[model samples]
Target: MASKLTGTVALVTGASSGIGVDAARQLAEQGAAVALVARRKERLETLAAEITEAGGTALAVEADITDRDQAEAAVRQTVERFGRLDILVNNAGLMLLGPVVGADPREWERMIAVNVQGLLHTTHAALPHLLKAAEEGPRQVADIVNISSIAGRQAWENYGVYNLTKFGVNGFTESLRQELAGRHVRVGVLEPGAVDTELGSHNNATIHAEMLDPFNAQHERLVPADIADGITYMVTRPRRTAIAELWVMPTDQA
Candidate 1:
């Protein structure tokens, strides 16, 4: 039997680690030619090689999506390699949890740059190709899945700026979904709660031990592949269907 994405192409940003890596692999497994975009060239190459060895087509595109030019170039490279783009997973993000009062302004800048600007740049670049794919490619629909967080929907004390960025992602996704509906470009947001990934490791030691560690030890968090499954499910649905938002949380998380 043919796979769900037999003739499609996908580009996943932040593909060097965590959710991005698994998402790219799952997309490739469904027979899509995937392009992995991340700042870490070596990790991207390794993943590309792993996917190839597993009988899937994959390309590594080293790029920092915060830079508009690099983001556009990444999109161009993916299209050039695969001929068309059918899916875009904007998965690059940063989470630095700390009290707003004494926080380093630099952390906020980094989060905003990667979580907000990076997503915007990559989406802007990929939209044209995705619209083209919806019109001309085998599938009559194309998809954009933005990886957000439960923080988007709820506010936490230490997660102030992270919450802001994710909330923005959710809002942008909904607005874009409406704007692109006529074009058959399905836009959706996946909000994941407490995943055991490198996403939280960027925080300083004080915050990590005080804020993240206790929560992690108490909760059975979601995994990278769990979120990947959500991504695949959203993108592989029938052309007549569109999922606007998906929130994935650990069963034990309240």
Candidate 2:
């Protein structure tokens, strides 16, 4: 039997746009109170308003998950406002693609900070509350869904650093799932391929001109909602079933 998410509270990072935004809306539709976190306050406020007007509960939490203190505070604020945290979607990430040689080192640093450290910061802060909710909240199981990418499974030449961060996410999620299985905290990694997101726009001019344009041209891209549907399915599974990982790609891509 599928588990219903009624009366549950879910915290979603990067809720300002793309897959995160779609996932937040979907969770609300499934009867969960959503805490939307993002660096863009206005965007978060707008999304929250839309959800609330549709008869769902939403909170706009403005925080850059890259900062450890801000990440912890986001989790604390969600628990304070909603009384518990039943689900955490670590969807905030920075994707900068370029070749390792002669690439702007700063871009690599930013990617690591946001993609890897940011996930760790939020997950660490939310883990305790998630475990508590699993033990005593309305739902007997809690979930932590980390958004990885298909790049995690296979590396591309110019996308080296981005692939590194995603691969790290995959390993970290698997390890966390093993550690938390006994506690009923389900940890999952969602790997998506060639999604039509703002991800490529973050690349430097050199890489964008030389690599991104060509790569995007050849791929049959997916929409953000497609990835959100995968997340919804994973979280809605019965307590006895945990979807450890999912890989989603455009049907015509391969």
Candidate 3:
């Protein structure tokens, strides 16, 4: 059952919208007390209310996880609210795409800050708690799920920076998985292709119009809940089972 998180607590970053919020809801539905982490407080609060109305426990934590202090605080708040964190979803990231030749360095920096640094900060802050949870939790297991993208696997001209960040995520998750396996803290990555999120809407106007929007209009996209479902499956396995990686693509996305 997806709605059975009776005693677990989960922290989902970027939980204001899209894959983040939906994944948080899925975890909450599955019986976990969820902590919603994102910079946007109002949205997080709204999502938290909806989860509560659905008879689930949730905490809305406003945090820009790109900032290390905020990331630490987010994890601390989760531990304070529910005593332990059994699941950590590092889903707080953005992509700003353009050709490397004339791209703004700021864009690259922003992608690195959130996609790479943000994930790192959250994972680092939550690791100790996750380790402890694995030792003293009802499920006898813990999970760290990093959200990546198809760009992580394939590089394209305009996707250089985004690709770099996701590849970093891939490498980091694998290394962490190996380090934490013996401790029962399962670490993994989810690579979803062309999800129907507002991920590209934030790109520079030129990139959005010429690069992102056209492609988005051409293809069917996976919804946020689709990725959320993947996350739920990864984190809910029995203590003896660990799903190392998952790559789900839209039927039309090659």
Higher-TM-score candidate of 1 and 3: 1
Global fold similarity of model 1 (TM-score): 0.98
* Cα lDDT over the full model 3: 0.92
Encode model 2's per-residue lDDT on 1-254: one tens digit a residue.
43378989999999999998999999998999999999999999999999999988999999998999999999999999999999999998888876688888988889999999999999999988999989996779999999999889999887888999999999999999999999999999999988888877776687777877887787779999999999999998989999999999998775
Q: For model 3, which pairs clash?
A: 4-30, 5-30, 5-31
Candidate 3's residue-wise lDDT over 1-254, tens digit each?
Answer: 45556799999999998999899989988999999999999999999999999999999999998899999999999999889899999998898888899788998999999999999999999999999999987888999999999988989988998999999999999999999999999999999999988798787788888888798899999999999999999998889999989999999886
- How far out, in Å, is residue 136 in model 1? 1.1
Of 1 and 2, the candidate ranking higher by TM-score: 1
lDDT of each: 0.94, 0.91, 0.92
Rank the models by TM-score, top first.
1, 3, 2
- Candidate No. with top TM-score: 1
Give model 2's TM-score versus the native structure: 0.96
Question: In model 1, how many backbone clashes occur?
Answer: 0
TM per candidate comes to 0.98, 0.96, 0.97
Error of 2 at 193 (Å): 0.2
State model 1's lDDT: 0.94
